[model samples]
Target: MEPPVPSKPQFSLPVDSDHKATQFRLFSLSPPHMLAFHLAWLSLFSNFFSTFSIPPLLSLIRSDLHLSSSDIGRAGIASFAGSIFSRLAMGPACDLFGPRVASATLSLLTSPVVLSVSLIQSPLSFILVRFLIGFSLANFVANQFWMSSMFSSNVVGLANGFAAGWANVGSGVTQLVMPLIYSLLTNSFQIPTSTAWRAAFVVPAVFQAVTAILVLIYGQDLPDGNYSKKSKRSSSTGSGKNFFTVLFTGLKNYRGWILGLTYGYCFGVELTMDNIVAGYFYDRFGVNLESAGALAASFGLANVASRPGGGVVSDKMGRRFGMRGRLWGLWVVQTVAGLLCVLLGRVETLWGSVVVMCCFSVFVQAASGLTFGVVPFVSKRSLGVISGMTGSGGTVGAVVTQLLLFSGSNQFSTQTSISLMGLMMIVCTLTLGLIYFPKWGGMFCGPSVEPISEEEEEDYFLLE
Candidate 1:
């Protein structure tokens, strides 16, 4: 017998026609929906933790390895550069192999690279390890794709934001935890400083491996079931699009490219900040390593609320005003974030800088949440591909920003470089003005009077 329609949930949570959950239930572990949520975020969390585990210990690593400033900048660029390639490939992989298998495979493959950090001897080894480990971030494409698969359009923003936002906290958590681990090894265990720093990596490496295993065992590709059991006729996530079709269709879509560029500034800037903020505090303010790491942690920890807040607001705006509202909301919040970033760079006093940084974290991370809020709607047929493109754009942006603005050989001061990044953010945000939809309109214009195309019709069925 067909299952009865799910009752309207009490707390604004409801089930969609596809049986996907509409409201988040944080503590639930029910299979398919909630279980997938936990595994997806947790796995990504470990990836983020491992990816950023080194930054807090940079001083120790720098001293031990004798890394120069130019070497440091290049290493930072290498991490993002590695992510760019993996994230681009991850989209089609999700479309073909399903997010569960694709995400699990990538995490497992890269977890060893995380472990290899303990073996680094020179700047080249450090850079190469960082680049290889960056591939773990490809799971981000799967995380979002999985959430989009399991949640209805009305709440996909919230799902994507919460998963990614919570996962992103790993960056902050690593900033705080890595120093403690290093300190424990050196001060308590009496391990030598050089050995202690290397030993510190074992924790995140283990954490990454374990989480990948959990995801592989427990996670689901869609609300219905595992992708392997899905019939070929199923319209669920990761089923219909072929690899080349998904890749080319997503690439051909102008809207996806625009989102990619905009996301580059918002999420990309967030990544660059994660890479440098601890060192920025240590160098500029003369704070000790532990204190620098703690301060930097605030920037990443803001994702706990700020990024999810952006998603909630985007869903609300989309509900009320449709795609036009989502676009306007994204543009406005991102612009404000850019302005705050500029202010953050200009603040001189440490306390003042901390305050500004906190505020900047709110808007920038929220802008990331907002970017994904719009991503699922761009092309349902090419959802994973578009996601990969935007995700890769973020890493590309970080790499470019790091190279041009904050590089060791650059003439600009760190403060000046930060301000320049904010300015670039503002310029990139204006591009949102160009995004429009035939059914829901755009930031400044009404829907087109021209007849709806087949693509528009498909979107209407999903969105309406």
Candidate 2:
């Protein structure tokens, strides 16, 4: 007996008679779904803390290490390089191994490197530590895989939006709290500012380590039999290669490249905004590091609102209308916002610059929400690969933008810098629109899928 062919697994929505009542009670009381949601959100928070903590600390790192602007730029490049490589490798890995194992492993690995950031004294050492941190930052890719798997396709956009939006809150938190934490430690304990910044790294590192443990203890493994079962049928019926073969072939599709470019542009803009805005504030307004951080934090907070709002709108409008429409809208908004920043370079009045930045952040984050919302609808089986490819595009975009920003022997003035970035966003937006427009009108109606239950919805949201 060929190992007693495993009984075909029964399929049904994982709901019980008490599910509605339980879901209602959970939402009304303390739902199990809510617990899962919080855990999912916390995973993103841990990931975000690791990723965004460096931006506010950049100035302190530069000053203490006696490093040049180029050195600061290189640190970011190292991190993005790590992310790029991680996506290329881990995207398929998630498909093979499942999200739970990959996410937990990556999160656990990141903790030590995060703790080690404080120990580095030399520029090369710092870059090395950052590269290590970046390599572990593969958690984000794993998290996206988890999200796509847990939630149904209809609500995947909203789920992804909420998770990503909340994750951005980590950036906001770093901006608001890091400066205050640094100031208090420096004054009361007489800790050197560099060491205080190290504490910021240490705290998040500990949190991530703890999160890894919790995930291992409490997180459920995503179902993997779906792909395996499908692949077996395909092979026996002479339909196609195994899962890996299909995954690789998916890459050859033109649609993948178009999606990748779109992701790249959005990622480039987001990284530019998150990583460089503080420097822009400092340069343009002469705000102290603390105030500049607070301003950046404010942008992150604004994203919390705008991001989810964008997702809700996308769901209501349908994918093509929702996804493409938001892309065009974001392009226009961001272009105008970027132009305004260029025009108002180095605002003499601090408040004026703050207002402009607040407005700019709304558009920036809206674009982010819209871009990620469309990832799952492309294909359920290929979500991990597609997400990985798109994510890689975003990383490339960031690398290119960073290169452009820091390029040339001549130092760029604040006005010229802002204007150039603005121009780039415009070109990128146009390119994305031209490539996506015809496809956009057709995507929403192309297929129909099951709707996710509230419990599934919560699970999906957290996965991202």
Top of the candidates by lDDT: 1
lDDT (Cα, tens digit) per residue for candidate 1, span 1-464: 99999864332346766677877887887777888989999999999999999999999999999999999999999998999989999988887778999998888888889888889999999989988988888899999999999888888899899999999999999999999999999999999999999998989988988988898888889776677777455556545545676688888888888998999999999999999999999999999999999999999999999988999989999999888889989999999999998988899999999999999999999999999999998887778889999999999899999999877989999998999999999999999999887767799898875657766666664432
Worst 10 residues of 1 by lDDT: 8-17
True-vs-predicted CA distance for residue 270, candidate 1, Å: 0.5
For model 1, name the residue pairs that clash: none
Give each model a TM-score: 0.94, 0.80
Cα lDDT, model 1, residue 361: 96
In model 1, which regions exceed 4 Å deviation? 1-13, 231-240, 449-464
Top-TM-score candidate index: 1
* Residue-level lDDT tens digits of model 2 in 1-464: 55776664332334333221111111221223333344555776777777777788788888888877777778777776777878766677777665556767888888898888878898898777776777655665666666566555555556566666776687688777767777888898899876788876777788878887876666653433334465567678987434675477447545556656655655556666677778778877788998888888887777677765655555555544544555555455545655654544545577786787677677666666666666665545566777777777777777776767743233786556656766666566555444342333333232133556767645443332
TM-score of model 1 (CA atoms): 0.94
Residue 139 lDDT (model 1)? 90
